[model samples]
Target chain A: MRIFVHTTYNHRDYLKRLYAKIVDVLKDSGVMVITNHDHEGKEDLTKSEIERMSDAGENVLDKMDGIIIEASVQDSEVGYLLAYAIAQKKPILYLYEKHSGAKSVMGYFTNSKIPDSVKIQVYEEPDLPAILSDFLHRIETGESKDLPTIKFTLRITPQIERFLKLKAKQYRTTKADYLRDKVIKKYMEGDEK
Target chain B: MAKSRSKIALLFFGGSGIQTGDGRIFEVTKKEEITAWLKELPELGILADIEPVFVFGGPASEVTPALWSALAKKIGELYPSVDGVVVTHGIDTIVYTGAMLSFMLHNLGKPVVLTTSPLAKEMQSPADSEGLVSDYRNLGVRANLINALQVATMNLGEVVIMHGNRVMRANQTIKSIGPGQNFFEPIGEGLLGKVDFGIKLFGHVRERGKGKLKVDAALDDHVCTMRIQPASHAEQIARMIASGCRALMLRSYSTLPYPQSFIPYLRLAQEKGIPVVCHNLFALKSTRANEEYILINDMTYEAALTKCMWVLGKTREREEFRKLLYRDVAGERIKANV
Candidate 1:
């Protein structure tokens, strides 16, 4: 699974160490991780990489299976990204440091309607690895309760129906699942008006 | 009770300006797609009635002198119909374009603001990765465009660059390096205004309604620039003049005397009826202005270079070139010390 890790800029040394630890735990689990922090003395992204990322927009988040944000700092930017990630329907693990003194702006979400894919947890530094491990396990197993579904029928050409049936059979899946995974999911993630 | 929004003519040059919904840089292929992208930022609609004119789609480095002339002409055409104009450009060459426009568009009215969303790599800092992430995604571009749109409706009248939180005169601006919040800095007292709680125009800024708009877009791009150094040879200067270099802008050492080796080439350039403009002359030292070379101080390198191109396009006659070069056009030169 692929994941993205983000955090605020407050409490520099502590957060940097936390980022390094989180990256280590994710890498140890054989999961691909993209992070905003420069934990390993890597040079910042090149001009071409920045252009590619800017052009990609929320599609970058769409490619990630989940997101992990350290919200111990009160940052409006983190809040904005959190909203975008939720809109992308990516499973999010919002981790706040226990007794960090500074309240996270993520607390504002508590009064609002929160989605099932979001899990907010306050933890001591020692609990991070375990929390991340459990979250990854749940993500891999699809343990989150499925969101409510609505049924709709669409009329399609016979050629399209035949193509869907053939694709589903070749992929060893039902036609509905094939449409949901391949067609609808992609359409919903892209170019939404 | 609501105020009427300003009608802004937005000339889109496509350099990190718009990111489409489907993860692609806007190429201006479809007009409808441009409208759709604009809808994503509704605050722009609230700020002004933007009439987007697609100029071109490419990196700003590809921009040429001819393109600058074309853009100036386009803005001239749109000048009468819109309250103001904003050009979206690439940060790489936005200052050059701004300086060129400041000279090309002879105006005494409405703000002609040039701005861009700088590349993320240019502003990234490993020490501030969290802030960089937010800036890279949307805050940087969004804030710049919104500010540019507002500045377009201001009382200022001149070509200016609105970047970060500073409004700088185009001719006096210089590109800055490192991971600072601002990518450009003014050469002298080049800052015309700023954006804080609200936009504040400095008293020295040219106000609207001084005169009618005029387009003097003629530019001769044959001028070359060279920085003088200890190991520099006169042959290098000779070769430039031999290769049909119309004008030469030599950057002199700030503290050191003008190199004795290049004196012969200065005489050679004068003998060939070519104007050699020297910039960055020592301000404290008295450098006598001779017929061999013209001395320039208190002007940006960009202004000196583009002014050479503009003057060359107008007149190459020995006295006429010097007169126009020393002329304070668009406030490029503070005081013609020569």
Candidate 2:
């Protein structure tokens, strides 16, 4: 399978490692890679060159089966490229590095803050094989289910829980039943889809 | 044999004559002196013999000892039988005073109308009194019709007589380009109606001196209202959730792109046990649970304000709030009825 790789900012070193992993994952798997920068002079390409290449349509996304984006570094070229892919309605496998402190590109993708259309995976180390295998499996098997759906993760006080229960009772049903009905009714309305 | 007519009390506090973003305080002259321009009302056959009480002060003045007594006398003059009150004030703290008055005058038979302008008096000559005539004329008319417990506030040309409880701001969401006008457009929401005191039709007027005002200032800055926007990040909602906010009003977009970002934050609100009231938007497919939250002012404008006001006054409890939030106000609870 042919895949296009997009990198950002000055994270070329990170991309080289990520690219090598991509090759290792798809060995003998018929995948081709494309980028707008010089292979050896990855150090020489300035921010303008990267931006210019982005503006120049390379026709790579149409030819490739899917897009692989590197979003580990903060405020880099790779993140903008990934955002462009998401906006273009292309299937994107977004990869990023997880950091506990400060805002990370990966956190932005994972937080229930972004649209659900964009799929994201965070890794501590470049484990392309595992990431690629899973992504390809999703494409080949059409089993896009259980792909880590986003959920609101705030703690509820006991007072609030009791309030919900009392409210559910007032609406003439158990809390579980009320929740089930609301979820089903909302989904059937086709608002999120 | 009635000793006097329904008394009209006009109170203008904190009126400003200059221009600035905060110059909404400059509206006292417009709202306070409106009774002097009752040419249209007499033609409409209203306010024919109504008593008129007028008072004015700077924007910083609320209900002061001297001011309150002066206003009280004005009410008595309008009608030794002064049955209602019409107050004109700066927009900034109008709702606070409105809520305070609503709490104090529970089940009041007489209507208390609050009105203001968005422009400064000096921006244009006598500019402060520009819309006063229309607003004052309407208050007398509205009070005469709906006699129910009334608490109202007006901006620009639009007026809303919200129940005492329904007086919360859009946090930093409210934006106004012109003076005295609402900072933000209703965002597909609109005005229900203005307060009037000209007629005596609805039977909302209560027995004289019957109700007590309750001032609950516990809200402080803990309660906030925000509009959900497209692409809004989860961190924004999460921060609010973690901050220990007791209540939040989520002004959802009208069927327009319906900010999908709210889906997750709303869930967070549910998980955190914070009460989230959804207004001005449609339901999403993957939206959290229904019983977990409350929805209001769905499509109609008037219904939402009336319902929001009534609900806000009834309970600070999440469950009770949700119940009241979903219930109909002005009979516009469900879409089918609208």
Candidate 3:
């Protein structure tokens, strides 16, 4: 599978590290992989030359099978391609670094409305490997799953329990499934529950 | 017999234990001490004739369901005629808790002041639990108009109300970062500003939509950001594209009026069917992409846009999230297009 990757230059050092890890993770998934790193003519090119390089990048996107992005860059350069993918409603996998005080890079997203076409995953340094593995597994298996199963022991009130039960029935799903799904979905979505 | 004082709901969430006027901070958080503290309020002429409704979250519990249920119940019970709500909580998730109340009770006519202290309630700070009660009482009368749309972070020395998705924290008199190097200097702009009370609750509350106001306990997730560089390889874009990401926020370089080179990713995203959000550029100018294909990230980080996107990710009408993304609120023209 061909995957178009976008990253800021600041994270270039970690790029190779993440890329190598990704290849290792997907090696046995029976998916033939093509990467953004495989493209040509990306050296210190001039202005017009850079345009051609963009054209080259577009050509790769034209042929690639999937798209992945490292979207921690506050000021992103591939706005054209990024905008294009959004306009096309492509299935994008977004990853970011976990920090105690996260300094958001994308002022646009931070300042504006989030589009519907994006799938977001947040991972810490220690857990990137596992998170990436899960993502790859889902892509390979075609599983539409929810994640980050953190167990929150709630001190339930009778009325609250009744509310949950009613909600479960209203949704036409089992109470266990409803609560579990709601918790997982809320966690993944970062709801203010 | 004459009717008792108006039911001034004073929900206290401390511990399951019952208290006297204890000097210990941790000790006062007990049920007895919390109840005593609450009981003292009506006598002090602060809540004057108002009944105190104390709701504890257990001594160790930060914000359990009991706490939320109490809050939600109070809101449901009061609706339009609520006088106000006083939330006393530990400093751990106080700000987040405040934000949740602000969003969940979007159309709230009454004020819900969320207060906390690094020092214990028993500690000898200028603004102890008693002082906090004084502040809330004063706030009820003085704060005739408040930005109800978003949470207002109020401390002992400061009462910062977020306006235009921007949170300004300072003393009651000041609004900007003054000469004193205060820690709460203005940061990023807030997405949603103070909600207007005069505006009918129906349009604003219903328009904001219904969902859970889950206080995120853990935010230790990674957000790998990258800028598209010149001579950037599509192969690089391809790897990044297929690497299985959570979400991608593609920003155009502010320097460039038109970033034509990056157009290929649009075609790639179209084929991939991923949600790629564009920032800092006009959506109409983004000619290569379609509306369904492109999403506009147009709010401040402090705004609910990020939270909204995360919420919309779970719904069956995930596609409709795009439509809801750029709706106007708090007198701001929130558009998905740049």
Every candidate's fraction of true contacts kept comes to: 0.00, 0.00, 0.00
Predicted complexes: DockQ each: 0.02, 0.00, 0.01
Q: Which stretch of 10 consecutive residues in model 2 chain A shows the poorest summed lDDT? A: A53-62
Deviating ranges (above 4 Å) for candidate 3: A1-193, B1-7, B12-23, B26-33, B39-45, B48-74, B78-81, B89-99, B120-298, B305-319, B329-338
RMSD of each: 15.4, 30.3, 28.9
Best by TM-score: 1
Identify the candidate with maximal DockQ.
1
Off by over 4 Å in 1: A1-193, B18-33, B120-134, B137-139, B281-287, B335-338
Which lDDT tens digits does candidate 3 get at residues A19-43? 5666555445545454434252223
lDDT of 1 by residue, B1-338 (tens): 01344789988775544433343434343345566556545445535678988786667778888988999999999998898899888878888888889888886498999988643223333243333332343334566676777788878898999876678899988987734457788766588876432356799988888577999999899887788887777789889998898888888876543677788888888888888888873543355554557777767878888888989999887789988988888988755443
lDDT of 1 at B230: 73
Q: What ordering of candidates by TM-score runs from best to worst?
A: 1, 2, 3
| Chain A TM-score for each of the predictions | 0.66, 0.49, 0.46
